[model samples]
Target chain A: MATILQFDFPYPGPWGEEGARALKDLAESIAAEPGLVWKVWTENEAEGIAGGIYCFADEPSALAYRDMHSARLASFGVTDIRAKVFDVNEGLSAITNFKIA
Target chain B: MATILQFDFPYPGPWGEEGARALKDLAESIAAEPGLVWKVWTENEAEGIAGGIYCFADEPSALAYRDMHSARLASFGVTDIRAKVFDVNEGLSAITNFKIA
Candidate 1:
């Protein structure tokens, strides 16, 4: 079953077009991460926060990525990271088109 | 273009098997809502909250539904109904598999 990983952290800037352009490489890297089916990048630049809802092939890969991400963020001095993972309720999800890839 | 609507509100129960069973009708009704593409149900049962990340056909439909939903929640005494709508960045999202359908 797939897993949904959601997380947010204190962040500022680089969420708009300019930021997207600047972060294209970073975005590409994330997209290429193994087991990551997709991600919806999220940000409230004005509120100084950013996160993403990620769909992963499974839980282990997602957790590994989360740990890696947390460590990376910590290296950059980001904190107060909040994260959670949920098992996809495929039957209920299908009703809402949460398709299984 | 698609829109993502995210919201959260306090709730004490009905997020597990029993709650889902009781809310089956509500879930079906929501799935049948016009302009709704899908909804990934979310809940932090321990924290007493429930919401979902909803994909809509367009921004207007999404906002319309949001307003309607807010009214309905109020009628049910659901306060603090937070909501936000975001335009899907198709290109960037495409890289992360946010297909525009």
Candidate 2:
């Protein structure tokens, strides 16, 4: 089953171009992992949070990515991170039938 | 079963305080809808996108929110909106057991 991992963290304060650069580097690194299928990065300035939805090959891989991501976020001094892992139910909706590019 | 709605879109260009203010207004309005349980707004400048993950009471309510949201995004001249709806399977993962505030 495809597993979905979602998480978000606040930027402590306003994140300028430097922060954007850091996130780009981190995302590229994480996406390079073998088990990750794809990821859709998301952001909302009004809410002051940033995160992504990742689709992984399996539960173990998803959990592994979670650990790695958590460590990386911590290294960047990003605290108060929240995340969840979900098993994608193909039968749930027509939207689930198609993958997000 | 709880339904999950995830989507994102580019901000066209740099979005400053005014853009954030517009989003805040939209979010507040959406959250006030009768069927929405909760939503997590996410943003990332490096990727140049913003969006959210929402939980709704059912499919109808989820779809309704999508239409309203899409229209609002259009009003703001935001294009390339992408959205997907999922039925939350409570048995998926331990993380699914807890909701993001």
Candidate 3:
């Protein structure tokens, strides 16, 4: 079953196009992570928060990536990172038009 | 551009297969909603919470669905729903292996 990984942290400024330019390299690296299927970059400028929603092949990969990413963010001076790893309800999700596999 | 809609509320679920059985009808109805690209049903049994992460074709559609779903959930005696609508960074997201098209 696929796993869902969500993480967010407080961020200041540089959203939209500029934000995309700045994060392009990091985004490319995330693409290469083991067991990663996809990721949707999320940002809230007014609230000053940023995050990504990710899908992984399994829980193990999600957990591994979560730990790695959390550490990476901390190294970048982000101290308030929040992360969650969830088991996807694949059967029910499929009925709602999301296909895993 | 796609919009991400995330909503979750407290629920004591009979998770796993039984949960699927219980939500099948609701899932089907959700699949038919306008502008819905996909929805991944999420739950945290240990925390007694349940919700979903959804992709809608646009922000208007997402907001509309959010209002409708919130009302429906309330009708089911579920309050305390937390919902968020986010704009997707499509260019950045694609680099992370997710294509919003």
Candidate 4:
């Protein structure tokens, strides 16, 4: 079963088109992360926040990514990062049409 | 272009095994909703919260589900429901290994 890791932090600029251009490299780097199945990059311009919902192969991978990503974000001057890891209810999720491959 | 809707509310009971049994019907009903691609049920027992991350075919579907689900949760005595709709950066997300089909 995959684990879900969600995180968000305050981000003030470069949303929409500019954001896509600015974060391309970062996105690629994240894709290469071990045990990362996929990541949905999320941002709320109105709320001034940016983050992602990630699916990892297991809890260890999810936690490892969270720690590494948190440090990376901290290095970039983000002070308030909110992150959580959840055990996915695969049976329920499948009933709601969720799929993992 | 799918939309992402995430919501969480204060819930104190029935996590883990109990949660799976309790939420099965709800999951099926959610799956039958229009334009719903899938849902990832999420819960954080330590935080005493429960919710889901859903992918809908469009913004309207996402918003509609949020409204309906919020009301349902409110009726169940959940007073504080936090919900957000996020526009996906699909191009960037692709680089991060995200796919929606």
Q: Model 1, range A30-92, lDDT digits (tens) per residue?
A: 898989988887666555777777888988998899999888879989889877666555546
Candidate 2 lDDT by residue in tens digits, B17-84: 44445455455566578677766454445557666667677779988889888988889899899776
User: Model 3, retained fraction of real contacts?
Assistant: 0.79
- Who is ahead in lDDT, 1 or 4? 4
DockQ comparisons of all candidates to the true complex: 0.41, 0.04, 0.72, 0.72
**lDDT, model 4, position B14:** 86
For each candidate, what is chain B's TM-score?
Answer: 0.91, 0.80, 0.95, 0.95
| Interface quality of candidate 1 as DockQ | 0.41
Residue pairs in steric clash, candidate 1? B14-B19
Q: Which portions of model 2 miss their true places by more than 4 Å?
A: A12-22, A95-97, B1-101
Error of 4 at B42 (Å): 1.4
| Residue A26, model 3, lDDT | 92
User: Local error of candidate 4 at A14, Å?
Assistant: 1.4
Candidate 3: where is the Cα deviation over 4 Å?
none
Cand. 2 TM to true fold: 0.48
Candidate 4, which segments miss by more than 4 Å at Cα? none
Worst 10 residues of 2 chain B by lDDT: B89-98
Put down candidate 3 lDDT per residue, B1-101, tens digits, no spaces: 68888887898887878999999999999999999999999877777877888999988899899999999999999989988777888789878878653
Mind giving the per-residue lDDT tens digits that candidate 4 earns over B30-55?
Answer: 98999998898887788787778898
For candidate 1, write residues B18-89 as lDDT tens digits: 766777777788898888988877666666777777889887998899999889888989988877666554
Docking class of 3: medium
TM-score of each: 0.77, 0.48, 0.92, 0.92
